[model samples]
Target: MIIDRIDRALDMTSAIVAGIDGGQYADASLCAGWTVRDELNHLVGGMRIFTARLTGTDPGGEHHDDWLGDEPANAFHLAAEADRAAWRRPDALEGVIELGFGAVPAPAAAAIHHTEVLVHGIDLALVTGQEKLVDDQECERLLGEMRAMDFSMFRNPGMFGPETAVADDAPGHRRLLAFLGRAV
Candidate 1:
């Protein structure tokens, strides 16, 4: 089940990365002050950080931000390249990675990793004039997880009011973020 989730997540990331060349703005999302490019970079940069955690290293001072005053793609690209290099080390995934928030087991972190891919995949698609990549099955799994989570991580207050509801079997990424209160 987890493997399937990862497969879908990875596919989403791959498609978004490949489709984007950073030109479209009409279909751009309302990610606060962030442009589509900035949102893509933020999501990719956040991946770089989390990927480093999987490899037992500090990913500098990266953050999981929703807003970008002037976030740069080149900067995020450089950071992502460095993080990729770190993942090549022989003992990278040897120990339990300190993922800033907590020390989660390697296998269990698949869900988190899956979450990153699915959520950011949307960010990339929205920014780059691409279509949504998350399908129904993956969304259901992530939605279930989010509903059970405490939801202070990505749940921005402006987006989800108390009355807003997230369907358990809705689109994967949408339900995932909504469950976290980022249904924007």
Candidate 2:
């Protein structure tokens, strides 16, 4: 189910975050103008925001706030734990979630959260030489889901870019990244 997918994504992302070297945090990531630290901070913030929305609590900060103050991995772990718990709540997926953009059905929000966690995990893995940690099955699954949806609305400079071309024989992760406009 969706919660299981979210859990797997969160676990993978937490592993990637745990393996990041201190010095590599400043390195550039596939996301334009975002360093590894920036991407991680955003991921952590997203987790916190989603959790807050799910539990009806204040997130206490903005999306771009400095979430990775001293120990980035610890921050990610804490947020991921909270996010996982929130998603697992008995009635978590029974209603609409109010987001910054608008209200989204709970299932849709879970899928979006799963995609964000997995994709950002891949982004960190690729840049930090931890590609082996990526789950190809998850990528393929999300890619298929995205293909069936109207993803064009999210195709923009700050979100997903125009789909980039990739060899048909590329690995699932690479193909998924290419589909999301990452130069994989």
**What's the distance in Å from true for residue 132, model 1?**
4.7
| lDDT of every model, 2 decimals | 0.57, 0.93
Task: Assess every candidate by TM-score.
Answer: 0.60, 0.96
Segments of candidate 2 deviating more than 4 angstroms: 156-158
lDDT of 2: 0.93
Q: After superposition, how far is residue 124 of candidate 2 from its true place, in Å?
A: 0.3
- Model 1 segments more than 4 A misplaced: 1-4, 25-30, 56-95, 127-129, 148-172
lDDT per residue as tens, model 1, 1-184: 6546656666666666666564553245535566656566666666667666766566555675532234344454454455445544565445565565678775555556666657667666655656555465666667677667766544454433332466756556555555544544
